[model samples]
Target: MSRSRLMSSSSLSVHGLGKRYGEFVALAPTDLEVAAGEFLTLLGPSGSGKTTLLSLIAGLAAPDDGAIRIGGADVTYRPPYERDLGMVFQNYALFPHMTIEDNIAFPLKMRKVKGADAKKRAAEALELVRLPHVAKRFPRELSGGQQQRIALARCLVYRPSIILMDEPLGALDKKLREHMQLEIKRIHRELGTTIVYVTHDQEEAMTMSDRICLMNSGKIEQLGAPGDLYFRPRTVFVADFLGESNLLPAQVDRNEAGTLAVTLDGGAGSGQAIGNGADLAAGAKVTVMVRPQNITVRPAGEGSGRLKGRLTDIMVTGSLTKLYLEALAPGLPQLVAAYPTRTLSDDHSIGDVLELDWQAQDAVAIPAGQ
Candidate 1:
């Protein structure tokens, strides 16, 4: 069967969605949209409401406020079964007694699809997941990754308009989890089914999502393409949560045209960085965020706008090496610089004083606390 025959996609809209449990708010009034065939991930740490939002979308929980529409049809009050959706959970949720083929066909059987048609579609679903040979095996006979694929296959067999996955790859090992991420992306590309996935893994979100909705404290903190949130984060929390960053406290000296000249706190050094579209006036306190990969380390006095620090640690992790520097200035925090392992030379020692600098554009000056 062609990809179109396996699944049909739909758009999703959430309007002022809110949920609460007694005095605790689970989700704030939130609005979101998932385009037809788009993959969006709800990303956050525990208690951040990503799962709460996913539950509301799946019709597993009723919202305290606002409405939900699937493919522009109101489904806020509908039961989970009434919503044309498929769900894959963290656990495989496969019945131990059922064969792989039977597991895949179970949803079809519920929908009254029987006999040869159910069997054939189940086979097709297994083939789509690249595990057609495992048809006769029970759930216990398959590997963790294989069982995950089977769970996904079961969802696809029903051709739900939208698919909801709540940390479906959470149970796998690191290597297998990464492999499954690519596999799921490939399947999404082929099937074009709208997917609203929830996970707390930032790397997973960066790898699989077309757009990521980062939730915090029962509210969305940021929503955008992974790069957008990484490179141009609006707040300090966004910068700190998505990846490692060197957030230096600074006081703005002046706004030179569009660039802002700032003096690092603790008398580290003076440098310039681009503001995040905020009106950063002279004397205002701000934090300049520089990604570890953006900082360049060189022999002392060899770089411009330099901050002198002692090389305290060198961690080599195969493809990349991380250098930790303790700033010589009393109040400055330690900084980390990441470089490809091949680009680093053995000339530098752990106790050596080094100069660290970065391009102005590579650093973002966000107003303190924002």
Candidate 2:
């Protein structure tokens, strides 16, 4: 119930941790290390193995291969209750018949804490969640958001070594979900508890994680900070999956002075771009990745870079405006640019010819095959 009781977190390590269901691989052999008090999110689409990895870590499922260690102790075959880990699922998973205080104290009771000690600890957990006033209310009497806070309070009451959350905010509405995201983040920061969260929402992962482990086809596709995964993706899938990208087909012309010069296919555009430290030989096929926000739109012949297109559509969404342009060159896909709504001139309209340009440092040229 004290601050020290809540702050005793631990590190987690997964070495070649894998899971399989007959011929289908739910999670490929993977190696990962989460530092003590670090917030890491397992992020990917439904079948990408994020949930499977979380399940394996929570000891809900046994790994077919590899080992899992928490705080330097092997927990690969430990049961869920014996792993010293707490979990928050999509559902609140609270006992409807129990009072909020009792629900939060349930874990301590199971651990054989006396009635007086359990009651005091439950009060402290509710205060930690800023919901001490709702201790007497039952789960059914509270709003969805309040119930979720209670669930988290329950998880914290036991003072587990690590906390694992599987889309804990998935059941809430958008506004409430966003609010709870901040609440959970605040609690994590205050408790300094090492947390492994699983979510399919990229924005959620980006907002909450110190590092994102992006999985694809039961394997880790990329692992890094949100900005690194967004701006310096290692593969085409990482580029396309994390955000909106203009993937221009190109052929490498040369690799000189840390820059890779490339010629765009269909003569759409040509420019120098940064590579991912790999030597790309001349005439090699590649894809130039440029984020929508990095593209600048200007009058023809006004910008330094050369790529001309006709504006096809304009969309305004409150603070940001999106411009869709179709290149004049054949075989090139349409390009999109997003800018602050106030920065765009009202004179620009659809069907207007415009020039597109981006800094070389802002673009990356990746191998075509990844």
Candidate 3:
């Protein structure tokens, strides 16, 4: 078998991509650029167009209006086989009748390579996936992880230029999933392949991806590295959906020095200000979102900008304690704080009045009213 060495493309670009089923639009016009050798994961809830984009790129489905380019070549309507892309699915599609050796050699056979060459390539691929010892075993005789590795070996046998993985680890147990996450990351680094992966798990995306394309409502909400998306999300949906947040409604208040002051209103602890003398006159009804870990809890009344709340519940999770507090005001939102166990000297019980304080820079003020 003549092995086709995988070559890296400059980038994969999707322009004006759209997909529709009858009257309903499955995906709106979407544009994305993935750099060569970059691990870009598409993350979203179900029916959010993540899978649609994947299918379109894989040539499994057609785009209503867009062109996909790889290394400056148009591949929008190319057949799957001609696209030179490797695909790994949620289910490991292995042949029960064939041994792991034959299964890994299947792609090379389909491309009309045979006999000694095919066998040699299959052996090499099994070695690449660290499954050389199990080459003679059938799919039914192997563990789930072994079978998955065989599936990956099959994809790599053809040495496709790009690899597309659609929730490939969704079936594994938590421990196995974490282990395979590292395995896949290692394999990707060794092969230096351009990979487009899809998953709904935020932690998985944050752990493995070089950049993440976050989707919502059939469109891309934001595209950035994990830290950027977590700390500097541009929209409310991106902030609220990516992680846990305490979203308090605030309004922009301009002071005499021409600075922006964000005011939260419900009662006393309601008003907070940031960018005191900056030029934000947008008057946008904004939502100030803070992470649970960002809130500092002191006794009752030491901090200057303090809120009064009664401890509603405490959850101890070995390393840290999750505290839930209800504000004294009738309609103010409940606040959640995560404190390291080492941070607290005397453990406070429920119903104790606690003061919650945070620096203005710790929370981000999003645009008014989403």
Measured with C-alpha atoms, the lDDT of residue 72 in candidate 3 is 76
Task: Tell me, by TM-score, which candidate is best.
Answer: 1
What lDDT does each candidate get?
Answer: 0.92, 0.90, 0.82
Q: Which sequence of candidate numbers ranks them by lDDT, best first?
A: 1, 2, 3
Candidate 3 Cα lDDT to native: 0.82
Clashing pairs in 2: none
Model 2: lDDT equals 0.90
Which portions of model 2 miss their true places by more than 4 Å? 343-345
Better of 2 and 3 by TM-score: 2
Q: Candidate 2 on 46-137: residue-level lDDT in tens?
A: 89999999999999899999999999999999899888999998899999899999999999999999999899889989998899999898
- Relative to the true structure, candidate 2 has a C-alpha RMSD (angstroms) of 1.6
Q: Give candidate 3 regions above 4 Å deviation.
A: 1-10, 254-260, 268-279, 342-346
- TM-scores, all candidates, are 0.97, 0.96, 0.90
Residue-by-residue lDDT tens digits, candidate 3, 180-261: 8998898888778889999999989999999999999899988999988887677778877888777777777753343335
How many pairs in model 3 have backbone atoms within 3 A of each other, for residues 3 or more apart or on separate chains, i.e. clashes?
4
What RMSD, rounded to one decimal, does every model reach?
1.5, 1.6, 3.3
